[model samples]
Target: MMLEANNNYDKVHFAVLAIGATAKAMHTAPSDIYLRLKKYNLVKELLFDCYDTLHAESIEGVVWNITEALKSRES
Candidate 1:
């Protein structure tokens, strides 16, 4: 489900969707993904801040990009 971002809530909504989709793809809980995103600040920098670009892609693409970003940032 694609959300049209007209306000802060929409951005938040999209972020949640992205997190949930990522979690599903990775076979983890949404809370885990949320924590990881928060830890890396991707929740803001990538998911929220880049909503314009991310939302234009497919959910699968978004999940792939997010997972790749997470992997790249891993210690």
Candidate 2:
């Protein structure tokens, strides 16, 4: 589902969604929580290129991660 949210709202929403999706996919997610081992964008990109490799990961992180990655790329 696409949401038309402002900056503050999107951050809050992304945090919530990330945590929830991560929990559902087990403790090995890249969205919420502190990520020291793997970055969110890396895991997200891997999921995109090889979804089979990340069978246990959440598909929802793709959109959120892609958006963040795009923002960073533009910077």
Model 2 lDDT, residue 50, Cα: 40
Q: What is the lDDT of residue 13 in candidate 2?
A: 52
The C-alpha TM-scores of every prediction are 0.88, 0.32
Model 2 CA lDDT for position 74 = 45
Whole-model alpha-carbon lDDT for candidate 1: 0.89
- The per-candidate count of clashes, in order, stands at 0, 0
Model 2 over residues 4-66: C-alpha lDDT tens digits? 345445444544454456545455554443252135443334333444333344556544554
Cα-lDDT of candidate 2: 0.45
Residues 1-75 of candidate 1: C-alpha lDDT, one tens digit per residue: 234435678788888899999999999999999999889998999988898899899999999989999998885
Query: Model 2 — which ten-residue stretch has the worst lDDT?
Result: 30-39
Top candidate, metric lDDT: 1
TM-score of 1: 0.88
TM-score winner: 1
